[model samples]
Target: MSNIIIGTAGHIDHGKTALIKALNGFEGDSTNEEKQRGITIDLSFSNLTKGQQNIAFIDVPGHEKLVKNMIAGAFGFDYVMIVVSAAEGIKPQTVEHLEIINLLGLKEIIVVITKKDLVTLEQLEEKKEQLLMFLDTFDFEIKFIHEVSIYEKESIEKLKNSLFSINNSIKQEENFFRYYVDRVFSPKGIGTVVTGTILGKKIELNEKIFICDSQMESKIKNIQVHNINALEANISNRAALNLQGVNINQIKRGDLITKKGHIRGFDGIDISFKCLKDKKLHHNQTYTLFIGAKKVEVKVLLFDCITTLETGYATLKADEKLYCIFGEKIILRNANDTICGGKVLNPIIDPMKKNQKRRLLEALDNSDFTAAYKELLDAHKKGLGIISSTQRFALSHERAIEFANELENVFVDVKELVIYPMETKDFIKDFIKIIYTKNTYALLSNASINLRLKWASTAFIQSALDELVNEDFLTRDVSLYKNSNIKEDFTKELETVFLHRLKQEDITPTAPYNIYDDLDIDRKLGDDILKSLTAKKQVIRLQHNLFIHFESLNKIVKEMKNIIKEDGFIDISNFKTRFDLSRKYLITYLDYLDNYSNIKKVENRRVFV
Candidate 1:
């Protein structure tokens, strides 16, 4: 069975703690400070069992100065019981606590009028009327209202029955186990112990848990639910866990203990904010944000025009990083007043520019993940957009491929997916435009393409290029690539000029730079022309800055093979004499032959393979 959490809210000395004791038949306050001061300073927990249902009561401090403690204690409450004294009626703290409860979005409230024995029947009737008027100003609906005097045993029994009736109607959540650390201490013989109300799934003994937003890991040594030894603790129940592999000093209030990889920490977050009253919120104003058991200082940046009680988008930049998930409700407070509260839309880095903010808002407004994914992709259309597997909107590799398949003609790689709003065919068309505009023959090398498109990974580029080649939009020849429709009208002219220069040299090919100067073409264009000829098998690039006509190289190979066949091997001097070539060209040709398996270089001689 799921546990029901009920929190008490009201002024100090108003019998909030006394009424708790009267209902459960035991004192909720276990500290000497609370007894000496005659008030609750921090949160105190107690469990009341009626039949099969168990209700957990969190008694929060009612002093105005301890309002932060009050907010912390009311983090995960399912119901709130407002304690108002019949003699005092409505006090300042009573209104403040009601405002906080409304801001927290808690809908169920049970007003308990305490100190009833101290007032006359007429006065009690008047007090009830005034409390009703006070509650009418808020949005929450009251579940039940009852008069209770701790001295009266019947009134206490009536309140317990009312609690049991409400427990049956509260809905339970089935989210993953998330327990906020409200108290961390070391008990003798137990090592480190953490106590908090479990807000999510059941936690079992020996379960590995991570301290949220931190790199600390601990295992549950034992579990205790409502002071009973248990193997597992159900959701909404108060639990004390004996933790192993962590020290008591390593954690504190507001740190979360949850299953690893279930949530991530973010420094900035976007929220849907609304003020409770006609209060103007300024940009860059610092406020305290209360979510779960954590309180973080955040600076507000409003996206829409500022107005009173208006709901709009805003970004909250925390002074320190905090861990939260989407749809988590947050309460914002100034130093003195509770201003507004809202639900988290996204938790991520800040959008630094107005355009990025617009894109983010548009993406968040979409109801489906696919639309949001597309908007994010459009925002980064100028380059590759990266979304890691750990992000909230990240799809699995299989799901990403499904999205790609759903969208026609869109290329996506599982290892490094790239999403674009335009079709992959259009992307190739644009890439062809770049290649055609830069070179006369509409050709580009892989290295050149990588330099122009630096944002894309090599894997993504290779995948896209292969898709374009399969689609007959481009052609690849060894290391050089070109558009399939490119005419290459100047290819023959460039090839004729290159071969003429090679022939002009005596027994050696001319260096590429000398040819570039002789032809009066740019070095890059010259190199592209030479690489194009080499790709077509019309020329052989023997080494760096060396080229030979393919036909002439083949004739030399035939003569060297015949000489090796007759003599078994040919030394460097003999090879140079046979070809009438210089030492540089002869050595380069021999290495090229060795590389192609046409000849084997054994020691200082070349042998026919």
Candidate 2:
């Protein structure tokens, strides 16, 4: 079922409460003080269900002193019900309330002229004309108008039917779960219960959420929709959640409940502001800022201009941290009057430098949120560090990845939950330069590349090198990287020199140190050439610094196989005597034969497999 939150807006003694009582059969003023004073001083809630729709009424205080409370309660309303007494006509608060409703961007309204029986028909017609004229100054159109006497039963029933017939025009989208705490109290046997209108998404039973102000966590024990027990509550509906792990005294109005770590509180923000009154907003002037269901003191710092009549950019330094985001509406008031209101441009931090402010304002002026995010990326692209998804974008890990994938930029995933943009062309150019300068068969170590490109991260350098290797531009050999496009002529020459020296020593090959020293070659280069020879089957590596010709290794393997077959098994001492070799060479040759599956070692003997 869809829900429509209809809030009452008008001056004191304007019959707002009486009008709700006539339609719902209950007075919205629940406190004795309101009844004694004959005026509402706080917010009250009631509901009426008809067919598949639920209509929740929020009655706000009509007095001037309680306008802050009215602003707090007006956040989640879908429509405004402006009630004017026909006998009293339009008053000061009537205009103020209308201004507030307009500032909230509510388009639907139902104008109800109450106490019709107290005035003559001519006086009532005059009041209706005056009300229509006053409404013409605003942008929203009234959907329906009714003149009713609550004393008459037929009149009450007709108003109720008309209200129920109003269609819900707003389309709700699936979003993250977030609910503003408007009313908090401790009910007997229920622990602590918090009531508010759900804005973005549904909240389920037993789900853990956090208080955005204090970062305190709690779990939902139960959910109620329109006073009926429910396991979950839908968006745009009035819901009361029974909570555990948090005390009633710890929570207050304007505290937000959302997924843990999804929101952050900040003491400074940037906004696009517009002055509603004729007064000028001076620099460093303090004002009460009403945002969502919270009110805080903020000092305004105007940019590029002195006064704000039309929309302009400004920074607000709040006395305390406020949990807000971009695109939220803000209402600013001085000591006595409502001066201005606007949309929040950015939260979580303030613009420190002049160029940063200019760029941010330009991005907001000419583009949407996607462009603004790209601008933020551009600022960090010059620096060599990664950007944090939570700090920069104000999003969770999963959501930030999704958002980044949707943009035109490419991000390189790194450790510590950070991401850096991959400048593909620049990195590939630098990598190719490093490989081309080496111009040798021997591969280069990662430490050498790191010394040349000190600005890039080790992970980024490794990733770029891997990309080159994957594209067949480079080949790797155990911590060494070589350019694949380099000619193999030098490697073949070195291999010829190494193999010829090994063959000169017959079955007992020359050690690697003697070959490199006699050939007048670098030791590391000699190792590389020997490894290449072993890979090509031209030489067999027996042990560290020992090499044997492949033909000699084959001869030794054939003799070992013949001996193992004839004797069933070959003992270590007997094998050393048969080969006419020392214990070290015999052991090395026998182990090599065993590794190639020519023989299997059992205890101290070798057996043919």
The count of backbone overlaps in candidate 2 is 0
- TM-score for each of the candidates: 0.68, 0.71
Q: Tell me the spans in candidate 1 whose CA falls farther than 4 Å from its real position.
A: 168-175, 304-311, 350-352, 355-359, 362-374, 380-470, 474-609
RMSD of each: 9.7, 11.9
lDDT (tens digit, per residue) of candidate 1 on 416-526: 656555454356457755655455454455455565676655655676677777877667776555667764655577778787766666347788877764444446767
Best by lDDT: 2
lDDT of 1: 0.75
lDDT of the candidates, in the order given: 0.75, 0.76
Candidate 1: worst 10 consecutive residues by lDDT? Answer: 383-392
TM-score of 2: 0.71
Per-residue C-alpha lDDT of model 2 across residues 1-609, encoded as one tens digit per residue: 768889999999989988888788667787899879999888888988887978999999999989998999888788889999999999988988888878777778999999999999999999999999989988887889989898978877888888888757352433467788998999887899999988766889999988888789889999999789998988778899998878888888888888786567789878777776565677777888998888889998888866543457888898778887556678888875888777777775743467777677666655354565565655555221223344333444566556665766455453533344556435544655555554444455555555555655556567777877887767776666666776454557668767777777756776786665455444676788888889988898889877888988888888878878878877677686677776777788777876865567889888876
